[model samples]
Target: MKLLILGGTEFVGRAVVEAALGRGWEVTVFHRGRHAPPAGVRSLHGDRTTGPEGLAALATGSWDAVVDTWSGAPSAVRDAARLLADRVGRYAYVSSRSVYSWPPAAGLAEDGPLVEGSPDAGDVPYAESKMGGELAATAAFGAERTLHVRAGLIIGPYENIGRLPWWLGRVARGGTVLAPGPRSLPLQYVDARDLAEWTLDAVAAGLSGPYNLVSPPGHTTMGELLDACVRVTGADVELRWAEPEAVLAAGLEPWSELPVWLPPGEMYDAMHTADVSRAVAAGLRCRPVEETVADTWAWLESIGGVAPRRPDRPEVGLSPEREADFLAKYDPAGGDR
Candidate 1:
């Protein structure tokens, strides 16, 4: 199989490139040359955001499938899809669950109502950009020939977002850590490698249309995740699990501040609770949380214990002083300290 991946140097894109190579498939990566892609594939240098001149290098390649992970303006996706539409047999766009309308109801599936977007749109919000990318891909490749991978919280090796990396770093610090609660709060996420593998398999099987790509609901609980972190790092850290109300009252946000944690409410339901039955039936499998945590920690350690974060994303995790202050006033056992 011949595959072309745009932005194949980091995160989900990197995972797909590696996965393709692992399957002994011919892979070609079209990236900006910012960071080196994996060693084996053919690499083409270009900046997709810079318009046609930047994409001149990609003018002549043909592949069985093309996977694009662009999260910026829809125009970039539109441009690439149109250029490759004639030569590439299928198009796969790595979209997000965020494309669903705000406050998506629990168990929302691939058919859920989506945010408004356009194929020719310029720079816009994340959700709009993703929806527009979907529109753009479909507009160029047709719905039957385009695959929309609507992914949820993606974490694993090569994670540039710093969610798991932040937790691992904080736990590795060996002190009292502010663990979000309720500890039993469930999480839903997909390992990038797993998503990549499923994507390739789906493409091979000639499947198209949007698939809510993530593990089943409650794939792992907050307690399980943090406990795995504590175990993996072997750091003498105490996970002081705090209540949802107290954590929010402390002015700490859910996803950005704590990372991968949402209080038990509508927001949590929207983010973590989704119906991925279509994907599961299509052969999606997730690794155990322990494996995901352990592998991510090992990857972080390999890269000098610091995760590369995307410039477009805001910083995640709690500040040391802020966590300390919150710990000082709140008692994990029950009441105020």
Candidate 2:
């Protein structure tokens, strides 16, 4: 099978490319050519943001499946779908859980109400635009010919985005690490390789429509997540529960620049937990979190994926009283304590 991937150089895309190649599928990638293509993979380069040049490059050939890990903007995806609708047998768009509405209630299903037109959604147009892209792709190729993979917090090897790595690095240092307060927070992440492998399998099975690709059952909560990280890194780090605001004031950023922090908010709440029965039923088998954590750390060590050092400024340790006060104000429920 000839599989063409859009945006095949970065974390998730690279994983998909690797998975596809491992399955002995003929894979071709289309990107801006800024980064080097994976060794021995066919590549065509052009900008997707500007015009039809990139679409033109892809117009020349046909494939059994086109997995688009990039192109979240509605217009770009719409155009690409129009261009390749007749050529490709299946179109898979990698979307995010962000497409769901905030404060997702328990057991949010694949057919749950999605976020409508919101300007703020365009801030990270990729996630926001994906909602529209899903509609457009489904409309163009029919629901049976398109697959929308709404992935959760993707964590695994070669994750340079500093989401999981920040926590891992801080914990490995064996220092007082700041963490979110409790709320029985549901945390779910899919290993990139697993996601990639599932995408390939879905294509092969001619699977279509939307599916939430997330961690399996009993794979929720922040404490378990931290424990897994500790086991992987062999770090005995002490965690200091602090207010989200205090952490921000201390120069920490949210995993993603979303509006909410505590559980049951926007981003976290939507993915605090998601039912993955459909994906599993479709042959999606994720690696154990322990294995994921260990593999991620091993990859980071090999690539020196340490957080860059900030300029040494005057130490600004929070006083015990002040820290306690901040924790009280923010973590009033005291779940993370």
Candidate 3:
């Protein structure tokens, strides 16, 4: 098999590249060259945001399949899909579950209504951008040849989004860590490597259309996840598990300040309870959360204990001052340790 990946130098894209290589497939990475792709694949340098001319390097080659992980503008996806429609045999767009309409109900599946988007749109919000990218891919490749990987909460090595890395780093600090409670609160996420492997298999099997790509709900709970982190990092921290009400009332934000945490409510239900039956039935197997956490810590240590941050995304996790203040004011387990 031969594969071409756009933006193949980091995060999910990098995972796809590595997974393809591990399968003994020939791989080509079309990227901006800001970071180096893995050693084995062919590299083509271009900036898709610069429009058509910047894509000159991509004009000459063809691949059995092309995986695009563009998240910024829909027009970029449109342009690339159009350019490669004839040359590439299959198109796989790494789309997000965020394309679902606002306040997606718990257990929403691939058939859920999507947000509005157009192939020609530019500089839109993340949800619309992904929706438009999906539209653009199918528009160019036809539904039979296009695969939409509607991924939710991707976390693993080479993660530039800073979710798991923040937890690992915070745990390494070894103090009273603000662990969100109702410890059994489940989470839905996919290890990028797992997502990559499944995508390659799906494309090879001629699978098309949107698949809600995530682990089954309750693959791991909040406590299990954090406990793994503490175990891996060998932190001597006390997990001050605070209730959702107390955490929110203390002016902390979910997802942003607290990273992977979402308070129990509509957002949590929407995010952590997606129906991934389609993906699971289609050969999606997630690694244990402990493995994910441990490997991520190992990777972080290799990279000097600091994870790279995407310029496009805002930084996550609570500041030391804010966390200290919150811990000082309210400890659900009683006064203070």
Candidate 4:
């Protein structure tokens, strides 16, 4: 199959590109030339936000499918979709779960109410921009020809967010580590390779409409995820689980400085626990948590554990001094000096 990918050099986009290539598909990547495409694929230089003139290079060839990872601007998505509407047989637009209304009620599906938007509401907010991109793609490609992937917390090797990698590197430190609790807190994430392979399958099957593209909610717990991290990192660390209230009271942030801990309250309790039965039934297979953790750590090793961590911002996870302080105060055993 011939595939065209927009923004294919980055995390999720790269996942699809590599997946398709591994399957021996002829792939062409259209990007701004900032990063080189993988060795085997063809690259076309263009900016999605630059309108028709920017996309001039893309007018020449046709493909069986197009996987778009562009969410910078809705106008860009609309323009790209319109420009290639006739050239591709199917269009797969990568939309995020954030497009759904924030703090969504528990058990909502893809058909659940989305963030309310005005036709005139500019994409000032990230959620609106993504939803606008979805609207733009569907507007150009039509519902029958477009596929919207509403992905939540996408984790795996190429993740730019540093969530999973933060945990992996922390575990590798091998000490009395601050593990978040209650230990069974559920996490929703899709492995990039898994999402990519499933995307190719959906495109091949000519499936359209929206799919909430993450592992089923409540399918994996906090213990499950952290255990996988420990097993993969092979760190000689002791995971000391602390209650969310204590963690927050101690000044650790959820989901940011502390990677995957979402405290129960109005913020994101429902967001991460969205129902994914539809996605699972649609063949969205997630590899075991251990496998994802192991592979991600392996990839991190290959790259010398470098990631997009900000130099100005101090490293995430607990600073040793802080963790020691917290343990002295919070850990019943008071292991800190």
Better of 3 and 4 by lDDT: 3
Candidate 1 regions with alpha-carbon error over 4 angstroms: none
Of models 1 and 2, which has the larger lDDT? 1
Q: Model 2, range 264-285, lDDT digits (tens) per residue?
A: 3554556656888899899988
TM-score on alpha carbons, each prediction = 0.99, 0.81, 0.98, 0.92
| lDDT values for all models | 0.94, 0.72, 0.93, 0.82
Clashing pairs in 1: none
C-alpha lDDT of residue 317 in model 2:
28
The number of the candidate with the highest TM-score is 1
Model 1 C-alpha lDDT per residue in residues 1-337, reported as the tens digit of each score: 9999998999999999999999999999999999999999999999888887779988997999999999999999999999999999999999999999988999999888999999899999999999999999999999999999999999999899999999999999989999988888889999999999999999999999999999998789999999999999999988888899999988998999899999989999988999999999999999999999999999999989999999989899999999999999997677777
Better-scoring candidate (TM-score), 3 or 4 = 3
What's the count of clashing pairs in each model shown?
0, 2, 0, 0
Sorted on TM-score, best first, the list reads 1, 3, 4, 2
How far off is residue 30 in model 3, in Å? 0.4
Superposed Cα deviation of residue 4, candidate 1 (Å): 0.3
Model 1 RMSD vs true structure: 0.8
